[model samples]
Target: MTIKVLVVDDSALIRQLLGEIIRQSPDMQLVGVAQDAYVARDMVNQFAPDVITLDIEMPKVDGLTFLDRLMKARPTPVLMISTLTEAGAEATLRALELGAVDFIAKPKLDVAQGIAEYSQQILDKIRMAATSHVRRARRGESGPPANFVNSGTEKLIAIGASTGGTEAIKEVLRELPANSPAIVITQHMPPGFTTTYAKRLDSICAVSVSEAKDGERVLPGHAYIAPGNLHMHIDKYGADYRISLLDTERVSGHKPSVDVMFNSLAKCAGKNVLAIILTGMGKDGAIGMQAIKAAGGVTLAQDEQSCVVFGMPKEAIRLGAVDSILPLEEISRMALAELNRLGAGTRL
Candidate 1:
């Protein structure tokens, strides 16, 4: 069956480009085009499209407001098309928070050629969005995570996720106490978006969260998010651990890949690590999580029902990389419990 798609963009050029891209795909069909949210709303009702490519900066009604209203009222799979300007970054993040499955950054110039250059990415995101579980926002807790206290063991926790990871990561982090072990995270995202994501989580969580800086020590209570578009790895210098960013070729088809971070954690921290492979779309972290398990580290994989795609964690489970599989809500609490067990020398 050809996947039905609706293009919503104020720019005629962008609409034309996206329409062309959708038409060229044998697996997808462009059902309609709308220049603004008003028309887009009508088209959505008329076409009942399987996926909608929604632009952030539209005339009449801004995409953020429309997205917020749409997700609450009707719920549809949306792939955000946005520019990552400084202000645009925050708006894009909010859009994701609202309900966008994923986004493709709009090129600042050569609109037609740029869209063409990224045609495959556009099509792929659309496909993924169509099959994805569109989750509505259920506001989580504010303030520090439940269990508390700073254990100065110089411990490190590494997390890797993609696809539905943004909210999944937030759910896990929101449960961490002020004195939680230092965390390093790699969430598949576009360039210029990770910084904003880190900031957003920081604002709500008790921990001091920031985009990882190379050579900075991995300190307790602070969470470091790998800067997007760059592969971030853990490095050990004696008892101290810091991050090293690499611009190397994409691993498992992602830059700032989960595999890169998890592998580095397994090699550097070994048994001192507590790692989790959360919701995502590929096998990037399976081998790396297995390495962690081999090195005596405790590993957690989000259970299948809780995952948006179930590809990454499912692969890890198949590979015997996971020590236990937990529902999404239990992960953070269980992580703290396991950390306490390890810190106190109690048997797992």
Candidate 2:
């Protein structure tokens, strides 16, 4: 099946670069290229593309506004092309919340030679976006249940996700109470984006959130996100767990790999961990989740119906590593419940 793709950008160079890349792929067809939002809208209505590569900064109408309108009406899978800057990170995250499947940092076009380096990565993102489920804009919901109470177990919660993870992670975090257990997360993002992402979560979530600093103590009621381009793991120091960041080779094809984080928890936190594998595009977390299960830690996975791309969780479930398969909306509630159960049963 050939994927029909539309390229939307204000720059002719970007359109040409992306169009060339798409045309070179045997499995893809360059259906159309639009230089602006108005043209893109017309092209979308005419071609009904299977996927779209959209630039965040555009003339007349910005990418976020266009994306929101598209999702509410047409609902096509989109991959945002974003610059690697703080402002770009913020817009890209908003695009995800509005329903983009994934994003790639725009190649440094000034150094035209560097653009070729991103060709394969851009192709891979398009392929994933072509197959991803495009969810509609969800209505705003209230916070965590008022009756909810944390176990205060001091148990650590580890979460791993990719692809459509940004919004999925936000949904889970928003459901956790202020006193919930400490959480460490890896959400497959480029370097400049995770800082903005952490700050965004901290603003809306009850629990404090920040990008994990090396050797920092992992405390209850706070969430730590692994920095982009680095692998993050927990190390046991005396009686407490501390964050450890490593400039290591890509594990399972990703820096800040979920497997690395999960494996470390299996060794350091042992039964005092509750690990979750969420929506993603690969089998990265399965092996480590299995190790966690073997170490007596509880594991949960997002269910296929709720996942944007049910790859990682499906793999974990296949390995017999997951204790429960749940919807995205239910994960936080369940995590809190499990923490309470573990708290009642064990001290460490």
Candidate 3:
């Protein structure tokens, strides 16, 4: 089936360029084009597009605020398109938090000469955005979860995400408490960005967060993010699990794939692990999460509404791999509760 798309931008040139790109793809169709969020909203009702490419800067209502409102009212996958400036970067980050599936940097010059240069990337992003699961905002709340803790079992936590994962991972990690379980996350990112992202998370979260190093012991009160360009897996030596970084071939088109981490957890940690599949672009974690479930491990998939891109978790859920589906904000608490329950032998 052809994926229907809506293009939203104030610039007539951009709208035309994006529409042409979408129409050129055999698997995609441009359902409508809007100059701003207001027009986009009306188009959403009329056209019922499967995906939207939103501009970050616009008159009347800014993209971020419009995104927030859009998610709150009628959740739909949104791909943000912005310039590659510092302000654009910051705005792109905020747009992710507001439920944008992914972002593409606009070229500096508006020359029609190079407009086709980014067509492939733009098409790829549009295809990915079509598979996202967006959630409507809950009534009367826009802040982080007030109660965030994992009290069920004391086992380690393993998470995997890709594509739009950088921002999705940040939202979940920022809500975690200092005493959160030892979390090992594999997010698809470039090398330098992972270090910056880890440090960024460390600054915002109550928990101690850092990039995982080879042979580093997984410990509570700390969150370890896998470095980019490498695959990070867990190894159980004695009573504790340690990080194992390897220079390996990409799995599911990602170096630090969720599958690699989840498979390692199934082999080394098994029932002593809480595995979570969050918003991402592909089906990386489905089989691996199944392994975890088969090994008697507890697994959770972020629900469609809470996901920026539902591909990863949706695949896992489709395979009957996830034991529960929770929102992004509720995941930390659910994880903690599951950990505590496992520790107390109250729940499996």
Winning model by lDDT: 2
Tell me which residue pairs clash in candidate 1. Answer: none
lDDT of 3: 0.80
**Per-residue alpha-carbon lDDT of model 2 for 1-348, expressed as tens digits?**
999999999999889889999999999999999988999999999999999999999999999899999998899999999988999999998888899999988877678676666898999889988888887766878564422344544488899999889989988888887877789999899897899999999998888999999999998779999999999989988767899999989999999899999999999878888999999999988999999999999999999998889899999999999999998888888887887765633334
Against the unseen true structure, what C-alpha lDDT does each candidate score? 0.86, 0.89, 0.80
TM-scores, all candidates, are 0.94, 0.96, 0.73
- Write down the worst ten-residue block by lDDT for model 3: 145-154
Best by TM-score: 2
Over 4 Å off, model 2 = 112-116, 146-153, 344-348
- Measured by TM-score, how close is model 2 to the native structure? 0.96
Q: How large an RMSD does model 1 have?
A: 2.4
If both were scored by TM-score, which would come out higher, candidate 2 or candidate 3? 2
Model 1, 87: alpha-carbon shift in Å? Answer: 1.7
Location of the lowest summed lDDT over 10 successive residues in candidate 2: 145-154
How does candidate 2 score on lDDT? 0.89
Q: Compared with the true structure, what per-residue lDDT tens digits does model 3 show for residues 1-348?
A: 899999999999889888888888999989999998889889999988899899989999988998998888778888888765556666776677676777887654446576666898788888877765564433442355334334433377788887667766776776667766678999886565567677777887877889889999888778899887899988887666889999999998888777999999999878888898888877998999999999999999888886767788989999999999998778777876777666633222
Every model: Cα RMSD to truth: 2.4, 1.6, 5.2
